[model samples]
Target: MTDEFAPTRFSHVKAGENGWRSDGLRDFFLYRDLGVAEATEGKVICHLVKANMAPEKGTGWHRHEAHFQIVIMTKGWARFMYGDQDTLVSAGDCVHQRPGIVHYLYDYSPDMEYLEIVSPADFKTVEMPAPAEVPPFTPWS
Candidate 1:
């Protein structure tokens, strides 16, 4: 039997090695690449995301085209909706987003930050109709 998978290498990303960039999926947030994509040969991606601006309008209803994905809240908190179910992800919280699950991130704190890991490095996010109304975001003082 032949192995169908390419070998992956060890990767280490030190803090301050990569600066956060605004060219992420959302303009209201910044992303810091953790060097996992290159090391894994595009098989996966790991990154840290943090709020860049106040949440006037959060990430609208959308879903990602990924086989596996998870968001681990590292700081602050965020409120998300998974098909009409309101979920508040606080610091140290982790959420596994099932593939093709329609969701919305409607609110978050000023210091909200999370680590996101997804398979297949490159993923497509498709916008979808809102399942329910979103709540107002807390004003940042």
Candidate 2:
């Protein structure tokens, strides 16, 4: 593969959380593609998730290695916690984070929804330093 990688198409849709569920939340996983695995090289791994927050619950802190995550809130509102800072992200707003950063979400509105994208394609290769104490939501802080 050259420096350029094939683009994957993603359509906004509703989905449910996988493996682990949080706060009695029925989450969703919209779409994901990492260049069909073999074709991915030095490229970004794209993921799209759609879910709604019911009340005062939020995702837990989590850390990533070799991946930069960019969360785009298409609808609703949410408060993102990265390190010592907390930022409220609403519809049409996006949050980006570098690798190995400790981050989490708090005070998610009842109608919060977002899409998370990871760069470097090899995101799956990252190993969690420790099993996230909280299921569904993993908090590093």
Per-model TM-score on C-alpha atoms: 0.94, 0.55
The best candidate by lDDT is 1
**For this target, which candidate reaches the highest TM-score against the unseen true structure?**
1
Give the RMSD in angstroms, all C-alphas superposed, for model 2.
8.0
Instruction: List per-prediction Cα lDDT, in the order shown.
Output: 0.93, 0.53
TM-score of model number 2: 0.55
Instruction: Give the poorly placed runs of model 2, Cα more than 4 Å off.
Output: 1-43, 52-57, 120-141
Residue-by-residue lDDT tens digits, candidate 1, 1-141: 235555677899899798999999999999999999999889899999999998888889999999999999999999999998999999999999999999999889889999999998999999999888887888788
Show the colliding residue pairs in model 1.
none
